[model samples]
Target: MKKRLWVIYGMLTLATATWGSAFIAGKFAVQSFEPATVAFLRFFGAAILLFPLMWVMEKDRKKPTLKDHGLFVLLGLTGIALYNICFFLATKHAPVIKSSLFIASNPVLIVLLSGLFLKEKITRNSIIGMAIALTGVVFIITEGHILTLFQYGFEPIDFVLLGAVVSWAIYSVVGKVVLKKFSSVESTTYAVAYGTLFLLPFALAETSWLDVQEASLTTWAAIAHMSIFVTVVSFVMYYNGIKEVGAAKASIFINVMPVSAVIMATIFLGETFTLAHGIGAGFVLTGVYAGTNPNLFKRKLKGNIVKNKTA
Candidate 1:
């Protein structure tokens, strides 16, 4: 049993590395395409690859239903559609690591949101972790700008990344509820399918389809990589790992992604570390640790909120 647990952990860690690099990979692709067009094509590309694969794979599973249609569209819009748009836009302005760290805040946000909705207790550790993580994010965001974010020449493109983080958190929480009715694969497949079609109008209208002849070999390779590895393989591995280990453990693995993003971005995108980055890393890691133990954050918050409610 212990060995199996370790294996699952290994798989999750590897998958996180892959996902972490996804931003860098997209970074490479976005150099040629605008974030919107890039976001649009990524879904279309994934659908072209995975839609057929799903039929071959699912073979006899029951087809999805009407309720599923609604849920799948919502999934597509929130998870794939909006998430990619925000991510591509963000990655363009921010270094891959900073962009990734910003979104990595999701684990902490999930805890707070889940506590509110699911009645999960927030322990002191969780609160401390979240505080530490937020401090890291601010330090990193300011690039250690203690006083003025304005000094950093505030780029709106980065805020798009912030939007992506919130969209994804919502996607994760809501998707979990939808998953109760559909298998993860089913939900994923339909979400991908709907997002592809949903995005098709703008994708075709603006993409300059004739440029297919002019696109360089490198661009083609990136598209293929994004389609197969990032879209298909990563999602499959994540689903597989989640099945093998519980979701909590699976989530912790996601925290590893920022490290990979930072490493890859530094090498690939020429990003660097400042003292602020060091401080930010501490905060982010602290937050991840805080999330691991919820008991500490909850005990304190419970009394305060209860008192506030009664008062």
Candidate 2:
């Protein structure tokens, strides 16, 4: 049991590391392809693999009704299509590390939206953590010059990146609804399929078969890495880890993502890490820890209380 648990942990770590590397891959891919074209190729490849995997894994699952298809389409739009388009666009314009930091703060936005749409309770910690996380995001966006934000307003790319965060939040919230009807693998496969279809027209507008054929090996390799390792393999491992260790424990591994992204961006992209990025990362990770582990302080308090009573 211990050995198997360790294996799960290793898988989770590798999964998150691959997710982090996706930033680097996206940067490389967008250098050669249009944002929409890059997104389309990545998901098109992923959809090809995910469909067969879903079929094999979910043979016992019931067929989706028309209503379920609607929900899947929503997931496809918000999570897959919109998120990736924004993601690639942001990567094209922003430093991969900075863009990744913005995405690292995604859970805060998700929590906020959950409160509004899903009626999930927003705890005191969640609110405080969100404030801290947003502060960190501001610092990252302004590059330590918070006053510049007031003077100049947000850059165009900031809104594009925020679009990615918002779309992902919507996807997660909608996924809660979809999960009630279908397995994760099933829903994800359908969503990817639909999302690829949605991107097809946009991709067609952006590029031709000749452009695709003319793309460098680096671009194809980046797309393959994102599709195979980041999308399919990591997702499977992450959910499996969640199943084995529970969501809270599994979520802790997400902290590894931004750290890995920063390292890869530095090494592969030759991007310099600024002091502002360091501070922002600190706050963002701390805020995510506090927000996600809502019961952490309560548990510690209970332990202290019991110890005091014994004393």
Candidate 3:
């Protein structure tokens, strides 16, 4: 049981890394495609990949009901279609680091929504962890001087990223309920399909896809990465991890994302990392670890005692 849980933790960590890197990819892709068009192509590709795999894997499962389909459409609309549109648009106006940090706020929103909608309990440690993690994010956003946030005020893109955060929180909370009724693959596959369908008209109205032919190879590769790895693989791993653990615990892992996003942006997008980013990441990671493992301090103290006795 412990080993299985560790594996889930490892996979969830990987999923967060991919999700973090996606901000960079989306930043690149939006240069070539409209926000809605990018959302459409991404899920359209994801659906194509997921459908056949789901059919092969779920041969013994019962078919979905009409109500199930409706629920999936809702998931597609809010989680995939709407979330991606907001995300891509935000990328156009904000830097990847700032946008990802704002999106990282979703963990707190998820915990709250899960408590309210899913009847999950909110522990004191959870609140403390959330507050600490959010503090770290604010540190990064403000570059160590939080007063700057109040003085400079928020950019328009900040609110757009906030919209994406709300959409994703809804996705995660509602997804927890849907997972009880469907396999992770089934839910993700159908949701992607519905999301793709939802984006079609908007994409058609907004952008000429002829731009796709003109896109550089780098852009296409980024889109493919977003579709396959970020959307399909990472999402499956994330949902599976949520099933194994719970939403609150799983959401904490997302604190790792802003760190990963900053690193990726530095390496690939030529962004600079400051001391504030390092300090904020440290606090965020510590808070997440403590929140998820309420007994972490006790266990560490116990380990120290054992080591001293051996010495």
Which candidate gets the maximum TM-score versus the true structure?
Answer: 3
* TM-score for each predicted model, relative to the true structure: 0.74, 0.78, 0.88
Candidate 3 lDDT tens digits, 162-276: 8899988888887888899788888899888988998999888977657867887888888899889998999889988878777877888888777788789889988899999
- By lDDT, the candidates rank as 3, 2, 1
Q: Candidate 1's residue-wise lDDT over 1-311, tens digit each?
A: 76776666666657777776777766666666666666667667877777677777776767667876887788788778888767766655676445655676766666655566655466665556556666666666566665764444556766777788777766665666665665556666777878777666756676675656566777667777777777777766665664554343345556666656666777877989667767776776666556554455577789899999999
- Candidate 2, residue 261: Cα displacement in angstroms equals 1.8
Q: Give each model's whole-structure lDDT.
A: 0.66, 0.76, 0.82
The segments of candidate 3 whose C-alpha lies over 4 angstroms from its true place after superposition are 93-101, 152-162, 297-311
Higher-lDDT candidate of 1 and 2: 2
Report the Cα lDDT for candidate 1. 0.66
Evaluate model 1: give its TM-score: 0.74
Winning candidate number (lDDT): 3
State residue 160's C-alpha deviation in candidate 3, in Å.
4.2
Score candidate 2 by lDDT. 0.76
Q: Rank order by TM-score, top first?
A: 3, 2, 1
Which pairs of residues have clashing backbones in candidate 2? none
